[model samples]
Structure formats: structure tokens, C-alpha cells
Target chain A: MTIENYVILRNKKLTEKTFELTIDAPELARLSEPGQFCNIKVSGELIPLLRRPFSISQVSGTEVTFMIAVTGTGTGILAKKQTGDELNVLGPLGKGFGIDDTFETAILIAGGIGVAPFPFLINKLKEQGKEIILFNGARNSAELIKLNFENELNSTDDGSAGLKGNVIDLLHANRKLFVNKNVKVFGCGPHPMLKALQDYCSTGNLNCEISVESNMACGFGICQGCPVHSASEDKYYLICKDGPVFNSRDIIL
Target chain B: MSELDFTVKIGNKLTLKNPVMLASGTVGYGNEISEFLDLSEIGAIVTKSISLKPRKGNPPQRVVETTGGMLNAIGLANVGVEKFISEKLPFLEKVNSTLICNIAASSVEEYTECVKILDKYKIIKGFEINVSCPNVKDGGLIFGNNLEAVAGITEKVRVVTEKPVIIKLSPNVSNIAEFAKVAKERGADAVSAINTLVGTAFDIYTRRPKIKNITGGLSGPAIKPVALAKVFEISRNVDIPIIGIGGISKWEDAIEFMIAGASAFQLGTINFVNPKAAKEILEGVKNYCLQNNIKEISGLTGSYEL
Candidate 1:
């Protein structure tokens, strides 16, 4: 968890609110794991105060790319950045996935911007020859933000675009495939979406993992502010510490 | 007592030269404002929460400013407990300030597991159990809302260490006083009030939410009134000491918390907006005592009638 500044190599719009940024912080890129994130320093003004946290969308050779949305001052400033501009980044912080052979079948569920952390996970799992599925949920087909993954896995769109309704609805619509075992479920997104995913996987008895979001001032595990409680099961897990990613059973969701 | 003698104790064992502290999460482990903060000048330093593992937190677009306050979904990102014990604690030890490691847990088990590592330190003066971070599902506000959880976890952690345990309570509740009373009865040494209120902000022009997460916990100068009111309610309900927190930006704000029955104070939200605000407060406390011909600062605590 190194806290340093990275220069923006490029910023391009992928959707109305979504954009992709390439940063020059080699150390952050080098250390980055799929589920981890960087806290972006607010540029040009100090009113925003603390940095914004983002899961590592993708990591390439000398640069790292994050699929970001222009939501507030912190990210709006980040979206507006040009090449050669210095953007402060503190990361690659948090735990990501380990491409274990034990997971024969893996599924990734992402909600809106939550789709950011999975592309790297997919590529990693592909090396192990593990089968993958992606169920993405947005308001509609027009709202679905897609990443150019090298043509792998089953893609489900919640809107009438590619599929219909919610991605979980599509999974339920295709529930017969889950009758088997040895499946690990990975999900990232809004609280309710994660809860829904947790329910579907648990009822289907699929092993599941999820990455949670929290408000953090330090990218390091210093702020107790990003606290999360596991369901009626074990205990608590920090979104910043124990996981941005956790076994679906590890948490209540 | 001289005006300077106004300082009082925060917990049973932790006595402050002044009764004000920078809340965990807001102060960033006392490093951000060491020169400006004079870390030793305040009653104590309540550090941000540390966990058993490292974290990455939320995705991009985690913070947004609301009407009177700001919303943040930063999900406590940290270097984990062992790293903090070695990396950050030593620096805190070097400073004259007594370190109260602020701890957060998602369950009765996680809180104990994380705090158990702290038991190994032997140097931390106290522990602040943060039961109210809005972003995490099991960790923050959930545990805070339940009375059984408030006492159950406090009692579980109480047996582990001899040091005082200060439970930091959440503000986003219909019954904050109920939570405070539970902490006092169960075995908590003191109770701190008003973690950030749950909130959200939007870009009206875009007609979309300002934060990518859609909703966040509100903090900063705007929450002072709500904090003062909560502090007042909980203090009246519980006999144990109350550490008031929320939007404490100035010495006057600190005084308001005291009168509201906070034996001590935590400066939240403002630390980032104004780095030197804590110093401004200490000086102001000194000046106010002198101007009012008040000798002890503790005398200001609960001076407000209603």
C-alpha cells in the first residue's frame, strides 16, 4: 500500500458518465491486483479534501487503466485530466483473487462501475483454463458498459440490449447450468446487488466471493470507517482490510 | 486552577492536557498534522481503524459534497494490523501523544480478532471501537443499530485487555441514546458519539448522482448541529463519559460539545479542509478561558442549560 502520485497518460470517455484513464505510476501498476484500488488525489482544488477510491480496472506494462465515472469533484477532475498531468494515486491496495486450480468454474457479477475489477481476474483465470461467466446489471441495454475482453465467457446484459431484465434474472433464467459443483462466484457492485448475488449463489450452493465498497480516507487499513459485517454467520470484515473481496459465505453479503 | 488547567480526562486511564482529539479516519494516524497539530497538545490521538488484513476500499468516484456536508464511500483502506503496529505505531510512540488505536469490526468475532493483535502492542494507551462506518455492510452502522450487538461485542473485547475501551457510536440512528446506554451498562469505559450521518449528493445538471456509489456518509462543518444535538441526547441518557464528534471546526464548536456533556472531543471532517484547524482550536481554547475568566476548561463541559 504505497501512497504516491501518478501522471495521467490519457483520459478517454467510454460512456456518458464513464471514462478510462491511463496513469504513469509504474509502481502502483506493478503492484496492482484486480480487486484492489487507488485513491485519486483531487486536482487543482483542495475543497474535496480526501482522495476517491477505485478498484484496479486493468493493469498493463508501464501504465494502469481505471474505468471511471464522472460522479463528483474528485472523479470529475480525474476525468477531465489530460496527458502528462500528475494525478496522485495511493495503491495498489487490498487483496485480489488467486487463480487457484481448485476453482474449475468461476462466474463474475458486476453492477454498473462495479464491472471495473473483473477484467484482470478473467485474464488471470483464463491462464489456468478455468471456465468463466459474466452477468452484468445496469438500468438498461443503453446503460450497460462493456469492456473489450478477448472474446471469452458468457455475457449477460440486464437490459433488453443483449439479454433482458437484471443479470441475476438472466442467471435465474439460466439456472440449470448451476446444477453442478466446484463453482466459485465473484461479484462486485452496489450493496443490494451483492446481496442478491449472495442469495442466488447460496440457494444454488455455489461458492461465492464478493468485493465490498467503503468510504476510506487512507488507502491503508488505518481507517475503521469502512467497516462491514458478515451475515449471521462468522463476524466482521473490513472492505479495505479483510477484503474488498471475500467469500460470499465469508460475509452475509 | 489556571485557564490552562481546564483540561480533563477522556477515559479512566487516559488524561488529556486538553479534552479534544482528532477522530480516527479524519486525522490519518496523526502524521498529516504532526507539525501543525503538535500531536501532544490535544488530550490524546484517536487513530484511524486498523484491521487484521490490508484493504483496497471502493471503486473510483467515492466522495461527493452534499447540501450542508459531504458524502464519502472510501471504505477504510489500510496496510493491516501487523504493518500498522510496526509502520505507524512507532512514529506515534515517538510523538508525546498517547495513542488510542481506533478499531472497527463487522462482527463480534472480527472486532475481537483485530483487537487481539493490538493486545500484543502493550504500548497503546486505549482502544476506540468504531462500530459505525457507513460503507461496509457488516462493519459499520449495522452493529451500531442493535442494542444486543452494542453490549455483546463490547463485553467480548473487554476480557482481552486491561486498557480502557472507548466505544465510538454511530450517529445515523433513530435511537442513538439507546446505543450509548448499552455501551455504558455492558463494560465500555466511555462512549463517543455521532459518526458521519448517512447521506448522498447529486449533480443536478447531469441529473445523476455525484458519487459513483450513489450514497455516502455525510461529514464536515455542516454536521455540527446534528452532532451537538446527538451529543446532548446521549449525554443526558448515559452517566459514563461522552466524547463528542461530528463537524467540530473551531474552539467554539469544541466548547459546544463540552456543554453538551462530552468530557472529550474529536475533530472530524475539518482536518482535511483545514490542516491547522486543531492548533487554531487549542489556541482558541486558551484565549476563551482567559477572556471569560474561566480557570478550568472542564468547567465548560455541560454548561449549556438546554
Candidate 2:
């Protein structure tokens, strides 16, 4: 990974609390893969000291985009960045989504801003000529991020969106469409949603991969700040190095 | 400018190319940060604290950002000495930088045993005994708080290696200089003053601790004044060379530590924020010396004026 000061291309507001920041970082965009992330320094000051880790939402040519939610001070500062500001970024970090030819169909599951990595993954899946089905869910219509992809289904807790339930419930209700096909599930969401998806995938005997999130100091192996328990071992795997993305069965979640 | 001496000696045996060293637990084994800047350009790279056996470290939520600092309870997670010699040393040997292995153990014998095993490696220039780590339930502060324990650990580890031994002192003490004195009297080559101060943070909504460990060592610009004071305190009371560490983020801070009594200084929390800090601070320090008409960088040590 490398640290570079990239010029901000655009900061478009996606929702009331969310924005999509595009940066002109040729090398980082070139090295980036779906599910991998970049650690962004929001300010030069030490108050918001640590660099904020963001998922690589999309990459086009020399531009890379991050789906940012103004959850705290760091991200709030990120949301206010302008078109010409320079952002110090360290990335193409962590293992990206594992795209192999093991399955013919790709079922993308995302909840809330967990939809960050899907736009990039969808582009890769398209290149492989794999059939893609996306199940997006959020709290309300205002919270849903519409990517305008083919074969897309959205769910909301309130009945203002496509399906009137969480993403997993929507997936269960529509299970017959892809259950018989050779499908692999890719999930990113809250803890409860991921747990629900893990159980669903396990009961159905499906292959799955998931992207997890954590509060990390260094978006590298050195800090040892972001750790997730290994499913098979007594040791913990660093989220920055071992994976931000891991096979569902390999990690305890 | 080329004639200006940037070298600083840490104790009688080890001389560093510059006064900027990467603090333990900040740079890990030195492979990740090496991608950002040349490690050989810096004074030294202190490896993360290693023990006799591998530690799994604490559970999730090991670090949290405070106001102007951060609190971390990493529990001294390392690959252990056996793994260090086999997996980590080979790469460090290639970096061509001064290597100081930080050793942490639950017992005095374990510290000496770890030193004994690492003493044979020619790449390792010195040892930084981590008796101040506040994360783990074992060794750490237990050995650091008691003067006798610090003296015993220093004397025993000194017996195992002829290499320079720098005792890393904890700031979470009533009188930090006393511990520095015991380290010096027990044959420690130098002392690194002001390890992280124990601090904690909480989430008001969740009504729980922010980190799983509850308490973590606080490091960043917030602790700079405290670290400078600790270095000055040790310098005034103890005759031993002091390697300052705590919240050293920039060259100005590094210079301040040297003036307060640090022979050399280690950049800790800054490494995480800016990976190229060591290289940048070294340049800043050199320019400061050249501008101030100081011929030797070491002359800044204990140059504080009341």
C-alpha cells in the first residue's frame, strides 16, 4: 500500500446523511479491487487523529469513490470536502472480494451503507459474464441507495421501498428464484443482518463470502487494532491484513 | 549542512544515525511502514513487544481515538521470540536499520531468556524491555510499578546480553525518575521515558467502555507535555541517557524532547497517522539544527533553560 495526496473530483450527496466522494488517484484506483478499502485522513489536525477507513465503493478510470456516512466527526469532515481539496489516502488495502468461477450466479446482499462495495463488485461480476442478483435493504426509502442495476431488489423496514422487510427476509421470500441455481452469496451489512445471512446460507448449504468492518488505527497488519476471531483457530485474524473480506465459514463473524 | 553531525549515541554502545526512532507497537515488525519510506534512513525501528509465547491479544475493539490522542490495549500481541527470530528477523536484517527488539514477559526469567535467545542476532542492536505495557493482565505494569521488580528485571536481562539495554519506563507512576534510577543502578544502558499513560473512554449511548480492555495506554499529541516532563524529571534526577517516547508527532516535538533531556526520541502515535513521519521529522530536525547554527544534534540533549 502507498500514501498519496489525491485531488477530490466530486462530493455528491446521495442522501441526507450519506455522500459519495470521488478522488483522482490513478495508482490507488488501478490497484483497487472490490471489498478492499482506503484509509483517508479527513483533516490535517490531530483532533481527529486516526485516518478513517472507507470501502472502495466504485472505481472508474483514474477516479475512485467512497460511500461515506456522516457517523462521527471524521466522516462529517469528509462529507464537507470540496472538489479541489487534497486528501491524503493510504490504500488498495486488505483482501478484496474473492471472485472465482466456482459458482455461475452471484447473489449480492447489502444492508444500509453496507451497499458500499457492491457497485465495484457488480462491475467485476459483469466482466466474468456471471448472472447477478442484488438484494438491497435499509431502514427507509430515504436511506436506500439506488444503484440502478439490472435484476435489483430493494427492501426497507418501513413499507416505502420494494419489499417491506429486511434484506434477509426479502431473500427468503424470493429464495425459489436462485435456490436451484449454482449460486454464491456475497454479503455486507450490520452484525444482525450478517448473522441472519450466515445462518440462512448455512441452512441452505450455499457458498458465501462476507466483508466485515472494524475501528482500525492502521489499515495494515502492523497496528493489530482490527481483529476478528478465526472460526477454526484459537488466534485472531487482523481485519486489515487477514481480511476485510473473508469466506463466511472461515470467520466466526 | 553535510558536515553537520546527525548521529546520537544511546548509551555507551549504540550510536544512531539520527534521533528519530519508531516506537514499539507502532511500526510492528517494520515491513508495512517500509513501503512508505526508507527505514534505513531513520535512527532505529523498535519492534513490537515480543514474549516467550505468542499472545492472542485482547478481543475486538482494541483501539479508540480520544480528543487529541488514542487509547490502545493491544495486550502486547506478538509472534513470540521463536517466531521473531525465524519469521521477522530476516526481513529486518535486510532493512539495514538499527533494530531494538522490545521484550515483554510475565516473569524476570522470561525476560532474560528472551534476551538470551535474541542476543546472538547481529542485526539486533539493542533491547527495549517493555515493563510499562498497561494492556495485559500479566507482566507489564506489575514489573514496572515496583522499583525492585524493575531493578531485578534490568539486572537479570543485563546478565544475558552485552548489547545496550534500554528500560522503557511507565508514566503511570508517582515518581517516574525513581524507576529510571533503579534501571540505571541495575546496569541498564539507557532509559526510554514515558510509555503511554493509562486512560479510558466510554460510549454514553451504550453505557459501556469503548474498548474491550476497558483501559488502554494513551498516546498522541495530548501526552507530549507529560512525556517531556517525565524525560526532564528523569534527566534531572538520574544520570542515565533518556530516549523519549509518548506523543512525539513532529520535528518540533522531537526537538523539545531532546532539549528536555532525551538523547533520542521515538515517534509513536504519529506513525499510524503519517507513515512517513520518521523520514519527514529527520529532515525537519536537520534543517532546525542548520538554521540554529548547532554543529551536532546530540548537543540539544538536556539543553533546557529554566
Candidate 3:
């Protein structure tokens, strides 16, 4: 992992609150994988002291992008940055998505800002010659982020978008698309949504991997900050070290 | 340019190449941060608190960011002393930096047993007894808050090995100086003042504590002023060498700790934000000494005018 100041190339507002920050970090971009993340120092000041962990949303050539939502002070500082601004980024950290499995079809599921890690995963799956299907969901159309996936399906709770209800409900409604086919599911989003997806995958016996989130200090093993319950052991797996991504069957949620 | 001496003597036996040591719990086993910077360049790296058996640590929501600081209740999560020797030590031995093992246990016997098991490792330069951890329910603050318990743990552990024993004192005590005095009187070579202050944060909407442990030890820039005061109080009242800890983020903070009475300082929370903090702080401190024409960094210790 490398920690260096990368200049911002773009900070485009994707939605009312969501934004995409493109950074000029060739080394990190090259080292990063689909499910990995970068811990960004939002400001030089100590008020928001800890570096905020953001998923490696996308990488193009020498630049790395992070999908951000202004949830608090850290992201609030990130949202205000202009092009050429330098950001201290520590990455590419944690285990990324496993794309080498013997599945012919890759199903991507995203919930609101959980849509962050999918674009990168999509890039990798396409390279591996896997068919792609994406199910994106948000509370409303205003909150939905359209990333122009090949086979994109959008959903909103207000029915103001592609389908009514949540992303899990959308996936359930279209279960026939992958039935009896060699398909693996990839999901990211809030806990309640991920938990529901975990249940849905387990009941359907579908192979799935998920990118989880937590309030972490150091996006490494040292801080022992972000821990997810282990399904196989009686111990806790650190999200920053063991994973920000895990097989659905391997973790408790 | 004249050569400047960056070395410092902690207690009588241990001598570090510099005064900047990575605090325990902040740098686990020296593996993760080793990826960002060379570990050998550091003066010392304290291993996370090792117990007789592996601790699973606290549940989820173990840490939360506070104003200018962060709260952590990791509950002394570690791979135990046996694993430290068998698995962790091999890598640390290769790093070639001064290694000070920090031990935490539920009883005095457990503390000594841990030390006795680890004493045979030639690579370990000293021991930093962590009796001040506020997160654990059993042994942590119980021994730290009690003067006799602190004395007993230090005296017993000191008997098992000739290595330097540095008691990591808690800032939550009524009189931190008294604890330092008792540690010194019981044969502790030095004392690391101000482990961390007991603090907590709440989620108003949920009406619950941010950390699952309800409360955690607070560190970072927020606790620097409090840490300096505790170090000063101990420096004035006690005779033992002081290795100051508790929120030292930069060289200015490290120098301030020395002037206030620290022979050495450890970077805690800053390591999380900047993995190369030790290297940067070391450079800034060296430049500070050269600019001030201070020949020996140790001379700045306890040099406070007031």
C-alpha cells in the first residue's frame, strides 16, 4: 500500500448529494482492485482527524475515482474540492472482489451509495468475458446514480424510477433471468439492504460476494477499528484487513 | 555540518536511536505500517497488548471519530504471547528495530507469566506494562487505578527479567504523579505517562454510545494538552525516565513533550491518518534540533522553564 498526495482531476456532482472525485494516483490506480478502498485525509486540520475510507469506485489509466456522499464533515470537505486539489490517499487496501470464479454471468446489486464499487467490478468482469447484469436502487429518482451499465435495472422506493420498491425486491422480481445459469451475485450498500440480500442469496443458494461498510479509523489492520463477524470462526474479521469485501457465505452479514 | 546525536536512553538499559516510538495498539505486530515505511528507521515499535491467551477483542463499532481525536475500545485484541513469540517475533526480528513488548493481563500472575514467557526472546529490548487500558472489563484500569496493584505488578514483573520495565500509566487517575512515583519505587526503569483518558460519544438520534463498549480511551490532538500536563506533573514529582504518549501527532508535539519532561514520545492516533508519521516527525524533529543548535535531543527533556 502507498500513501501519497494525488491531485484531483475532477469532482463532478453525480446527484444532489453524491459526487465522483477523480485523483491522479498512478501507483494506487495500478495497485487497486474492484472491491478495494482508499483512506482519504479530507482536510489538513484535525477536526475530522481520521482518514475516511472510500471504495475505489473506478480507475482509468493513471487516475482513481471515489464515489462520495456528503454524509458528514469528512465527505463535506471532499465535496468542495476543485480540480488540481491534492488529496492524501492511502490505498489500495483490503481484499478486493473475487472475479476469477467459474461463473459465466456476473449479477451486480447496488443500494444507493452502495453503487460505488460496481463500476470497477463491471470493468473487471467484462475483461474476464463474463455477462453483466446490474440492479441499482435508491430511495427516489433524485438519489439514484446512473453509471450507464450494459444491462442496467434501476429501482426506487417511491416508484419514480425503473421499478418500485428496493433493489432486493427488484432482483426477486427478475430471478428468472439467472435461474439454472452459472451466475454469481455481487452486492454493496447499507447494512439492512445487504442483510436482506444475504438472506435472499442464501435461500436461493446463489453464489454471492458483498462489499461491506463500517466506521473505520485506519484502513489497515493496525487500528483494529472495523470488524465484521466471521461466519466460519468465533472471531471477528477486520474489515480493513480481512476484508471490506467477503463471500456472503463466509461472513455473518 | 556537525553530527547531531538523536539517540536517547530510556531507563538505564535501553537506548533508542531516536526519541520517536510507535505506540502500542496503534501499530499491530509491525506488519501493516511496515508496508508504508521502513520499520528499522523508527526508534522503537511497541507490540499490541499481549495476554496469556488470544482475546477476541470487543464487538463491532469498536472505534469512532471524535472532535480532533478518536475513541477506541479494542479490548486488548491480540494473538497471545505464545503466538507473538512463534509467529509475530520472526517478522519483527527481521525489521531490526528496538522492540518493546506491551503486556496486559487480568492478574499479577498473568502479567508475570507473560513476561517470563517473552523474556527469553533476545530481540525484545524492554517491556511496557499496559495496566491502563480502560476498555477491558477485568484487568486493565483495575490495576492502573490502584497504587498497590500497580506496584505489585511492576515489582513482580521486574523480578522475572533484567529488561527495562516501563509502566504505562493512565490519565484517568486522580493524581498521575503518585502512580508514576509508585512505579519507580517498585523498580520500574521508566514510566510512559498518560496512556489515554476515558471518554465516550453518543449518537443522539439512536440514543446509544458510539462504541459498543460504551466508553473508550480517547487519543489524538485532543488529548495532547492533557498528556503534556500529566508528563510535567510526573517529571516534577517522580525520578523515573518518562516515555510520553497520548496523541502526539507531529514533531512540534514531540518536542513539546520533551520540553514538558519526556525523554521519548510515541505517535498514537496519527499513525492511522499518516502511516509515514514517524518518518515525517523524525525529520521535523531533527531539523528542529539543528535549527536550535541542540546537540543532544535528551537535553530537551524536562527543560521546561516554568
**What is the alpha-carbon interface RMSD for each candidate?**
6.6, 0.7, 0.7
Please give the lDDT score at residue A189 for candidate 1: 82
Q: How well does each candidate superpose onto the true structure, as a TM-score?
A: 0.58, 0.99, 0.99
Model 3 segments more than 4 A misplaced: none
lDDT of model 3 at position B277: 89
Worst lDDT run of 10 residues, candidate 3 chain B, spans B30-39
What would the per-residue lDDT of candidate 1 be over residues A175-246, giving only the tens digit for each residue?
A: 565557577888888888889998988887888788888766654544444556666533355567677888
Evaluated at residue B165, the lDDT of candidate 2 is 97
Candidate 2: deviation at residue A29, Å? 1.3
Candidate 1 stretches with Cα past 4 Å from truth are: A1-253, B1-3, B205-207
By TM-score, is 1 or 3 better?
3
**Candidate 1, DockQ score (0 to 1):** 0.07
User: How do the residues A1-253 of candidate 2 rate in per-residue lDDT, one tens digit apiece?
Assistant: 8798999999999999999999998899889999999999998888899999999999999999999989999999999999999999999899998887578999999999999999999999999999999999999999998888978999999969999999999999899879799999999988889888889998999999999999999888888999999999999999999899988888887
- List per-model TM-scores for chain B: 0.95, 0.99, 0.99
Best by DockQ: 3
Give candidate 3's chain B TM-score: 0.99
Candidate 1 Cα deviation (angstroms), residue B188:
0.6
RMSD of each: 10.2, 0.9, 0.9
